[model samples]
Target: MNEFQPITVSRRSSREEREIALMQIYRQVLERVPYSYERKAMAKAERDFLSDKIGVRRFLKELGHSRVYLDSFYYSSANLKFLELCFKHFMGRAPLNRDEIRDYCDILMKQGVHHVITAILDSEEYRKVFGCFTVPYARQTKYYESPKAYLESDILNHEHVAQRGRAVPTLYWHQLGLNCEGGVCITIEGENPALQNYHPEMKEAEAPQGTRIQQELLELLHGLDAVEAQRLVASLHRKQDRA
Candidate 1:
């Protein structure tokens, strides 16, 4: 909303801290806001939040139901665009793909707006990521269990919405060899984003926990010379002996 201020929030934050956090939530959820207080619904939601009547999740629920949200994101925008916007606002990433977009559209068409909100807010993913007190933020791929989550998150989080100023699904053009980051995106050899933190793949099986542990250990020992590795091993042995 205003640059990117760091919001160090927790369940135990003071009222003033929570108020500041609410500002961020408003900016994120109501991307097309007039003034928060100027809107009767927004004002009431804020009051309920500040007075301890609702948590950040519920505040988001109310905001999603606001006329501003319905008018701008749901009514005016295409369902595909609306789906991506909901992911961004509520779940903090793009829909995994066209299949997800269709599923959400079906929900909206059959169930209604309240169900749309309930589905996301009540989802296990939502609870695990944002919980009750936390405000949803642009989540990283690792935060999700879906193998496709990072692929979509990496591809979309860096891009602006309706970048063409046309409301459409984020993947409306993905089939046209949009490629991906790291190995997925076919770019000039050095031009693709770093493989360490940002990468893309439609989906992948997670390595087993034991394999992950081994990989972590390998990472720790990667650059160590023989003597250093010996010393580290010896140190660990000593610690075990003490235990």
Candidate 2:
């Protein structure tokens, strides 16, 4: 891609506006990019593009935050379009089809949700409520097979869904729900001794240590640019080899 290839994206409209856009893209990417080959190649490409467009420090920072509240931003249509444009700029050609690009962008919005949620789960804040069960797989893969299974046939493609049930499940009693800026607040902190006592053992295990969604996204910018960077490095090595 030309270094100076001029591309246009919608200017920053608002915080919510941008977040909404991110969500939309995330959803699109999830649908389009499935299976091992596409997943690996796309992840590599995304990582490369992100590093090149955004510096590593900034990218990691974004990922760190994404570990927790990824859904807050993903699942929005507007953000997905912006992300697609970003991907286009990163790769010279349109590497992702329109739908594929859209879906991946949505997935990228969740860069660091795992880390943040893990931290919160460990915190004293919700120890009582979260003491039972384990956070379910945030991302899960399921295989499909037919009755006519040939030994040589590669198992058909798989399906994936964001795991809704956390490792622990919470039971809520019907008390007056509090209406706050945050969603439903059903607990009175420190007052619920019975609830705390009833809770089960809280596990402190960690999720995979890596980029949360946003961080992955930020890294993706750099990764995209790095493709050219590596090419430059390789070309330099080639010249040195010739010399």
Candidate 3:
């Protein structure tokens, strides 16, 4: 196995960007750890078996036996901001791997949890810049699958509308933009507005529910001690905000 490498980030990036990279790195380390899939599956099956063998009320009580499994899957989450920042510094991007992408499904099987990853990777916010890499859904859309689908009318014009409504907020990726001693600069352009608008409707028609969950998630990131909250907020897309 390849030994882990250290990354030297540019001094010019903003404090926020640095923080995000750090948080993402923390997430990357967590991703490398192993979880017990067989144990969880066996336990779940046992619960069901017991439920079938016993009465409903008895099974209900037994179900509480797996509270740890439920908590880790449904409630527990690792902080990825440090991991994101580390990737930004070393590779200048986020790591896109099967283990990284599919771990959530391994941990949990709920519909809502599945949608969170889909929205971030599939949304225009991601597609606009890095372009789409994987389509997790059965019904893939053209915009997500093809960058050419983004017409001038869709993003530019819609940006005007979003700006008018104060709905779409601009994000600066400059290394030193938000929190830095000064001197470094880098900017990233994201998905156009028109296509971005369609993202929410196509996925859920409500908003990015993942972000709301993230607000609580931020509180749970315990291991990383040196990072700040603003940095993670910057990396996150404002899915819940109204347009």
Candidate 4:
């Protein structure tokens, strides 16, 4: 008679494996550890079966339900800003145009923030591009460049720079012969009459129309030789007069 042998195969339950996967995805997508608010929200979501069978939509909805998300993003000052953040965080790109921003803003206002988030997460575009398990990443190629390039490029903007608690000092503007006050830039002294007028304290005489044109020409053709630039300016003046 042969002795019966018992086979032992080790395997995690599907539900347990799913929970582990969900936790990992949450860490990736959220880009941070679970704070107290997030922990509480996640617990509630788990109880509600949202985190159990996690899809992008359910995951984002759970995040949106958190106090941190509501306080940080939903209550941001501007709807456009909030929409922009949603694109950056969820779709990993900037909004394509004003129409897209407006449409999403309308969704946010009408459907609430969580619905706005879910709509984005469940969108055909998101599903086609990112799928269920893939983590979202910045789609703008420029973002991969140096931090200075990212900050100065149109992708981040002044509002985003300020929101990140990093100071993009006005020294850059000063170096470029500009003076910034209250976020408005004015040309430094002797730059241009139009820009000079912007500085009320300068007390400089208003330049003649031709002088202003010449100043603009000088600025535009700064890289050219002075004689060539002057000739070009004179040619432009002649053409303007003929017109």
Model 4, span 59-150: residue lDDT tens: 56677667666666555323444566666667766565444655775677677777778888888988876776555655444333455445
Ranking by lDDT: 1, 4, 3, 2
Q: Which stretches of candidate 4 lie over 4 Å from their true place?
A: 1-31, 46-52, 140-243
Q: Rank the candidates by TM-score, best first.
A: 1, 4, 3, 2
**Compared with the true structure, what per-residue lDDT tens digits does model 3 show for residues 45-156?**
4344333333222221232224432333223323342222222222223323323323432323344433443444344644553342111111123343234223211322
Best by TM-score: 1
Model 1: per-residue lDDT, tens digit, 201-222? Answer: 3122464332333233333333
Least accurate 10 contiguous residues by lDDT in model 2: 164-173
Point out where model 2 deviates above 4 Å: 1-77, 89-95, 105-243
**Can you write out model 2's per-residue Cα lDDT over 110-143, one digit (the tens) per residue?**
5533433234334452234223221111111133
Candidate closer to the true structure by TM-score (higher is better), 1 or 3: 1
| Error in Å for residue 84 of model 4 | 0.6
lDDT of each: 0.59, 0.28, 0.30, 0.49
TM-score: model 4 vs. ground truth? 0.49
Candidate 2 overall lDDT versus native: 0.28
